[model samples]
Target: MQGAPGKRIAWLPTLVAKRQDTLRAGHLRFAREAPWSGVLHCFVLDCSGSMLGGQRLALAKGLLIALFDRAGASRAEAALVCFGGAGADLRFGPAVPRWWNERWLRPVGGGGGTPLASGVRQAAQVLELSARRKPAQQRWLWILTDGRSSDQPVRPRHADEVVFVDFERAAIRLGRCRTLADAWGAALFAPDELIA
Candidate 1:
């Protein structure tokens, strides 16, 4: 899926299809299990300008859809939050089981600046609210970003678990993400490692 830098973006339909297939299979494996009573997985995606290149946003959307399918099969609830251009928005819902889907996720065009702090803060709030409603539910926060933002949150105190998936290419240096992950005691995974 490599492309010349600065060229107009091209949509890769095949890749999207393949991603959906893989995720569907993964979800099928979990479908046999008894439904978890109370659990929510929140996927926070970075929709900043930096994600426009390398089809990062496309891949992320695919991953989110896949995750939703898998979580649903496991009988877990899910939600979505997207942040970019100085603000964060809760695009999807705190829907349980069948409520999550690709249709809920809007295609976010990349431009302006990255508001990383806004995204993180909003995600934490979502988790906090969920915890209040369903204290027994296990909450997981999965953050996908290139880690190119200049702003950062003080620290998140709400999530039961946080995982940072850095999509930045190998040539680029990961600034603040490692530190942020360390501070939050969150698991950190890179794109290369995840796809491998």
Candidate 2:
């Protein structure tokens, strides 16, 4: 009773009774075993021309590097996907960044049409592959974009949780990030919130 809720034990008599009468099924185990062990932090960054102005891309890159630091501190696996123009690239990894640095993120260039859908689709594939290898790992998708793209909202299939970071700045916003977040029922955050 003094441990985590996940560590609680129950007789589960009904579950045992559901089994056929046999010596092998006679044991009554009580300890609860949660399936998840840790989380995989997946970052999907939009590097479109729209983000080039106002240093949005630079902000996103900075935020991503910081997030990798946080993930490393938490002992979580980290991955990166950058999208622009026509497609998405799995730029970094679906692995932990043992030696992470600004150099690793410096090469992510931006300036083209926003392929937000492609980014989400590619991240979904990465998450799916990781899910197969680590069945108990929770996957968290972090999307950083200016939300200026015309691409339709695409919800990732394998992500256990999704967060959309909107970078759009203008008198009248497109709100594409909010739309995508709503489509996936994900949490939304502004670029300014990166500090907190």
Question: Against the hidden reference, what TM-scores do the models get?
Answer: 0.75, 0.81
Each candidate structure's count of clashing pairs: 0, 0
Q: By TM-score, how accurate is candidate 1? A: 0.75
Each candidate: what lDDT?
0.70, 0.78
Candidate 2 residue lDDT tens string, 116-167: 8899888999999989999888788999998888788567778877888889
Worst 10 residues of 1 by lDDT: 25-34
Which residue runs does candidate 1 get wrong by more than 4 Å?
A: 1-37, 97-99, 192-196
Candidate 1, 78-116: lDDT as tens digits:
878898887998877677648666666665666767898
lDDT of 1: 0.70
Model 1 clash count equals 0
